[model samples]
Target: MLATPRPRSTFSNAQIAAYFYSPCRNQYDEPVPEYFRCRCWKIRKQTSRNGFTNLMQHVRSEHPTFQEEMLAATTAQTSSVAH
Candidate 1:
């Protein structure tokens, strides 16, 4: 018997860290630390400057098929919730 594929939403430690520590520009044009930003915030800035391309590369190299599986699972969950 074949094993069933699992739904994927798991993100890497680096990606998770980046989500919280990245800066957000405020209405006055001053950058505000995100609510969860900590000492690692500077590292996130240096790493994420290239944006999605950089992220996708990280995902591809580290997580392989996880990115595609995550997208599919998110889409499925969103559609189901909408209905």
Candidate 2:
């Protein structure tokens, strides 16, 4: 059986921030609020509370390796920075 190809880990912090911030306006030209532009918003809009809970539950299940890589990158960045 062919293994599923992993999603690329090439997304940068700026790209992740942009996804959460969604600096672009919506279709009606209304700006999307920062609070409503994130994965949280997507979860809220796309599913019920139970579904949202389930979705989060399986995040690492679905992408365990990616999550580990992201955590390592974040930890390295935090450690490298001086107060």
Candidate 3:
């Protein structure tokens, strides 16, 4: 059986931050508050205990391997900086 290809794990913190912080505007074109914004699956941020918990879950479920790689990369980067 053919295995599914994994997504690239090179997404930077800036990219993830951008996804979370991307403005959610209303029909009036005004920006909705972060708490009210739907981060994924058209589910509002308020649905989760924390504004980002559900969004992060979506990432974890949708891109499990990539997320693991991202965490490893982040840890390596941080350790390198401390040296």
lDDT of 1 by residue, 8-80 (tens): 4455445433432445566996775422333223222323444444444444455555545444554343233
Sort by TM-score, top down from the best:
3, 1, 2
Give all candidate RMSDs, comma-separated. Answer: 10.2, 9.8, 8.7
Off-target runs (Cα >4 Å) in candidate 2 are 1-26, 29-52, 75-83
Count clashing residue pairs per candidate.
Answer: 0, 0, 0
Model 3: CA > 4 A from native:
1-15, 35-41, 46-51, 65-83
Determine the backbone clash count of candidate 3: 0
TM-score for model 2?
A: 0.27
Q: For candidate 1, what is the total of clashing residue pairs?
A: 0
> What residue runs in model 1 are displaced by over 4 Å at the alpha carbon?
1-49, 76-83
lDDT minimum window of 10 residues, candidate 1: 35-44
Candidate 3 per-residue lDDT over residues 11-75, each given as its tens digit: 54334434433556789989766533324435445343465555556555665554444455554
Q: In model 1, what lDDT does residue 39 have?
A: 29
